[model samples]
Target: MSAFLRSRLLWPVVILIGLVALNVAFTDHFLRIQVKDGHLYGSLIDILRFGTPLILVSLGMTLVIATKGIDLSVGSIVAIAGALACVQISDLDDQNSVSGVLIAVGITLVLSLALGAWNGFLVAGVGIQPIIATLILMVSGRGLAQLIADGQIITINSSPYKLIGGGYWLTLPFSIFIVVALVALTAFLTRRLALGMFIEAVGGNAEASRLSGIRSRGVLIVVYTFCALCAGIAGLMISSNVSSADSNYAGLWIELDAILAVVIGGTSLAGGRFSISGTILGALIIQTLTTTIYSIGVPPETTLLFKALVVTIVCLLQSPAFRKRVARKRPRPPVTQTPVPVSDREPVTNR
Candidate 1:
């Protein structure tokens, strides 16, 4: 029980539950889920639906961070991917054609893979710092997206494309299924296939992992590539939800959110160990906080401040170093001795 309480994931879970309970306290029907048109409808479902993109991005960020690297370009990749797909779909003669939409998605993803490869090259092949390498793309990739968008938002009119984000399946949001599948796939690859050990080894110590017969450079490249791919998928979901791609704002500051989620999920930014389940919870917490802000009528301008405060609290509570420091500050109980009766005492006889 004590170990469980001390778990890194424990705080995030507690925070998430607290947020849910807070919402339930404020809104009478916050916990209620009703099915209409064969689809679930409720605040909970909405949270899951809206938080899907962040969860996906955070999942990829988890792997990247686990490899002792960061991908600051994910937000830009998201914008670039969405804009490219929207432009493709808009250009199709039959925008409603399923095949055309699929083609567009494929093209966008393929290009995203290429972009991921580019980041991988800069970091692994060129020996550039991960942040600096990804930052270069972070700055330039948005411009590339704007160019694809022709400096305007591109609205797509494809029903099949829309299904990726806003559709329902088995009476649940389809986006939830995507997240589940991706999470499962990631778990299988990392845990079942021992990929996680390699990642951890690389992140724990790259040079040592290399000397120990692991291909550090290849691992770094693969991790970055996978991270970008996740961002690409998130981009698709974000744009499809609204049926349009706003190149400038499609995924603004999402990288920061993703990093926060990853950190909140107990993945160290310094890189080594990571937790997928924790990340999902972190994403949920973030989404729930947003919902809570609106439900409680927090002014728009103060929302960020409110969120930062909550996040800071959570981080501090979860930090082992902080916990130790706090523990050190706590006063210790003084030890007291009782006087022994003369008849029963041996006295201070020295031999």
Candidate 2:
């Protein structure tokens, strides 16, 4: 029981359950799921569906953070990705063609890889600080996306493209499947292979990892690239869902959310260790909170404040130091002197 309580994932799970309970308290059928046209429909399913993109982004962010590095360009990459893919699709003779969509997607992912590689090079090869290196793109990437989008939203009418985000298959959202597959693959690579160890080694201590013959630079490049790829896929989903790409607002501030999710998922921002499951839960928590905000009718002006307060409370709860401090302040059990039998007591001696 103590071990279970001490588990890093405990607080996150508790907070998630608390959020769900809060919803259940105020909203009827919050936990009810029913088959609608052979598709499952409910607030829970909606939370998972709508939160898919954030989950994917946060998943990638997990590895990058695990390496003690931050990628500020993910949101920009998302915007650029959607802008580029939509631009390509809009120019296609058959926008609905599966092959055309595939080509566009391939192009978008490849470009995203290159962008990730560039970030890796800046941080690893150029020896620039991770923040400044990624920030270069963070600040300028939207402008580049705007340029690709011609300073306007690019909308498309493509059924195949729509399937990437809004389509349902086997009575479930396709986005959920994408996230599942990616999460599985990431888990495999990190847990079942040496990749996870290398990332941890590098993040734990770069100099020591290098001394131990781990190529820190290469690992950095790979993680950043992978993170960009995730953002690119999320970009496709975001654009496909709306069938439009708005460069300015497509993925605005998503990086912040991804970072928050990572932190909330039991991953330290200082890096070294990470939990993908925690990240997923964190994303869900945020999504659930968003849903709760609407269901509970939080005033529009104070919604952000409310969200911030809840998140702050959760973070504090998750902090070991904070927990220890609180524990210290708790009143400990009173101590009572044990009564000894007269036979066991020594006789009093007085001089």
Candidate 3:
């Protein structure tokens, strides 16, 4: 029990459960679930539904951050992906055809992979800093999305495409299955395949990893590509759910949220060790916080401020150094010993 309590996994789960309980206290029905047309429906289900995109983005960001890198371009990638897919679907006469959705998805994913590779090249091949490399796309990706979308919100009525985001399978949100599959696959690839160690080594010390025979460049390229891929899938989900692609607003500031989730999950930004389970918990926390804001009637202007405040407090709470300092005992002032003992002992020194 002690060991379990001390585990890094403990706190985040506790915090998430606490937040859920808090919501329950306020709403009184936060956990209640109902079945409608064989689909589970409730606040909990809604959280899972709405939180899926953020979860995917944050999960990808986890790998990048684990390599001591950050991808600021994920939001833009999201927009581009959704825009590209929607454009393809909108151009098709048989909007509801599964083939149209499949082609669009395939094309979008390939494009996303290429974009991710571009980031990898700039960083690994060109030796540019990861932040700088990703920033290039971060700034330009939105424009590319707009150019593809022609500065218009392209709406489609593709039922098959919408299923990716809004459909239910086995009475649960289909996105839940996607998130679970991705998470499981990531765990397998990282832990089972030993890629996690390579990533950790690279992040812990790139030169050391290179000298030790790990292909650092390959790792970087793979991670960055995977990150963009995750963002692309998220873009699809976003566009599909709404049946529209608004490039301008599709994934605005999602990178920040993803980073926030990664940080909250207790993953070190400096890179090294990471926790996928922790990241999932962090994403849930973020979604919960967002939900709590509106349920509690926070003003629109102050909502972001409130989120920042909460995040700061949680980060401080999670910081070992900060906690240690706060919990440390103050140094007792050096005790002043009277010199009288010397005089008192002088009589015994004759021997």
- Model 3, 1-351: lDDT tens digits are 999777676767777887788788788778999998888999989988999999999999999999999999999999999999999999998999898789999999999999999999888889999999999999999999999999999999998999889888999989999999999999999999979999999999999999999999999999999999999999999999999999899999999999989998889999999999889989999999899888878899999999999888778878888989999998899999977766577565654
Which tens-of-lDDT digit does each residue in 228-313 have in candidate 2? 99999999999999999999998888998899899999999887989999999899988899999999999999999999999999
Off by over 4 Å in 1: 1-3, 328-351
Candidate 3 global TM-score: 0.94
Best by lDDT: 2
Residue pairs in candidate 3 whose N, alpha carbon or C atoms collide under 3 angstroms: none
TM-score of 2: 0.94
Worst lDDT window (10 residues) for model 3? 342-351
TM-scores for all predictions? 0.94, 0.94, 0.94
Q: Write out the backbone clash pairs for model 1.
A: none
How many clashing pairs in candidate 2? 0
